[model samples]
Target: MTKFDEQYRDLVFRAIVDGERVVDRTGVGTRKLFGETMRFNLQEEFPAPTLKKLFFESAKKEMFWIYQDQSNDVRLLREKYGVKVWDEWEQKDGTIGHAYGYIIEKHKQIDKLIQGLKENPHGRRHIISLWDIEELPYMSLQPCAFQTIWSVNRGKLNCQLVQRSGDLGLGVPFNTAQYAILVHMVAQCAGLEVGELLHTITDAHVYDNHVEPLKEMLFRPIMRDVKPQLHITNRTQNFYDFLPNDIRLLGYDSHPQIKLEVAV
Candidate 1:
């Protein structure tokens, strides 16, 4: 079976239905339509997409643009990955304050997170928060309510992602894979084996325009042979030491691409 199969799909489906029902019946117009919780046992599988072709190149480029490049110029993203979603966020100085790369470089947040992991591997409070509430006013698109927590238990690394809002069509797929990779990388640096990834979304919603495509997914059969595996080439203690070549995904199989409208 794929990393995400019937079980995962069912849970998400149920949550969406319940949320929609609540909104329809209670007149709570603000009630969410698609919120879900997912837990991946790392020992069992590396949760990458196997039922559909996941654009690893795009994923890597986006990650690099956000966490590695210290610039917020959406032009770079457009040039490299054809992603110009941040065009409006660009500053006159050829930078954007809200860009992930800008934040990482400006505050050294990733380094701080790594230090926290090394100093207190067993601490329950290990977290790296990307969305700075104070900086929201400066953002082109305020951080979309994403938070990640990493912890160690008996030499295994566990990660939990809490998202207040999820654009399932365009964002969830990439978000899931990126965080999983983050967990893998952190675990490698900490000399710990990757354990589990728990994903919880408070207001996960499929855009109204994506409903038809999702219905199609329910009827389409999943490719059972595709399995995703992560190959890490470096075993360095420094998280920053990791290079693009150091990590790779293997044995991935999936269906044709499905497109959905992004509710920006």
Candidate 2:
């Protein structure tokens, strides 16, 4: 089982306040373009908050919906998981172009990424691009302005996420957890072990509307008992063969939920 600490939360808080203050006082949004830098060495610890219950299955399903579907239609997500977070972005034709799911649905890309890991394990350039600038006009929120790079070294998989803008308090937590799981999934499929996750955000700002809620979270004490453990079965070479139950998280404990607003 893995327990997340307050170090990331505190660092992100500072980055958001400082970045937002700079943009407010200087009228320059560049600070938002260049986000904050943070890293999580999974080898040292798994980064799930000890304060609130983090749902691992939900995170895994969401990731499956995005990269696996090749369609960003919220209805599909709702059908499988009953989540409508992207309902507003649904198109009239009942299709949402290569949002996150679209890329995963592509056969060539997935094969290439897997092959890259096996052939070039030490290369940091093993990246899976979700946001295509050319397709931005068709997207709803453009899948977090971040790009992800995943690599493997000495049988350990490492992941790095580079973001142009981030709503640190709300988005970062989910993004971090979900992507961390993604790294786990990829590593499992690639026959490798989990390593570290390095998250770097450019404009890591807590939305103006979420400031108070964040303050409230900071005041509450973290629940230290809940630990996260990953369970993966079916040692198959094909990533697509992985089912929902193939990977599981056991014994996750946390405090009450904290509500926060999103900038969208």
Candidate 3:
């Protein structure tokens, strides 16, 4: 198991043992902690949790839908990539409205981000945010892992993801590995080496329905001897050129997937 898997297990344990039980917007409720952070050195190994299987293909396709496709159409995601995670939130017009990819496309955020990273590696202003207060009302669901800050150090590229809220059981694992892959892709496009991925969550919680399964995950034996790694097969100089097949995960051994309910 990766250090991240250990940390993830610890975080879940903390929530069960020390988190406050509270009602949330979902009505499913949560055992929540106010603030939490996880850091991974991309140079050592990938940060995917192995206690339960991660849907790597789905996560990769979703990331592409958000950044590369920059599309708000959930139908396109389903038809093109065979990913239906966003279908639950698909609006009447067959889209997620002005959330996520819409905002990115509108503001040309991804283009500017890639350009900024390439031109000014040491620039402190490298940031991308999906939370547009004005457009929030039209969105089916606001971006959860919404902001990213990029920094370059000693020929390495690092990313800090700031999430306003994270569902500990489901969303956290996907976001953790998803963003790590993003960092790797962006780093490659910028002609830099992989460095670190730092994730910060303002409100991290496990829904009431997920506590037991998470407990089961925490107690399961971890494959400590196995090491998981991420491989980027595409050397696409532009981040937008990346396709779902361009990335691959190697040495990912894990237990059976644990089913959990999404509070949405």
lDDT against the true structure, each candidate:
0.68, 0.66, 0.90
Return the TM-score for each candidate structure: 0.84, 0.85, 0.98
Q: Per-residue lDDT for 169-237 in model 3, tens only?
A: 999989988899989988888889999999999999988999888889988997887678898887888
Each prediction's RMSD to truth: 3.8, 3.6, 0.9
Error of 3 at 96 (Å): 1.2
lDDT of 1 by residue, 134-253 (tens): 776776665553578888888899999887776655566677777777788878777789998888877766555556676666666877776678788888877767776777887776
**In candidate 3, what residue range of length 10 has the lowest lDDT sum?**
234-243
How many backbone clashes can be found in candidate 2? 13
- Candidate 2: where are CA atoms >4 Å away? 1-3, 15-17, 22-34, 104-107
Write one digit per residue (lDDT tens) for candidate 2, span 1-264. 233456656654575455535443223331232545667766555577755456556777777776555456677788977765566567776556555666455535666777888887887678777667776677655667357788777789888887766666656667777777777777876788888887887666655555666666666676666556666686777777877778676656666667764334
TM-score of 3: 0.98
Displacement of residue 233 (Cα, Å) in model 2 is 3.2
Question: Backbone clashes per model, in order?
Answer: 2, 13, 1
Worst ten-residue run, lDDT, model 2? 24-33
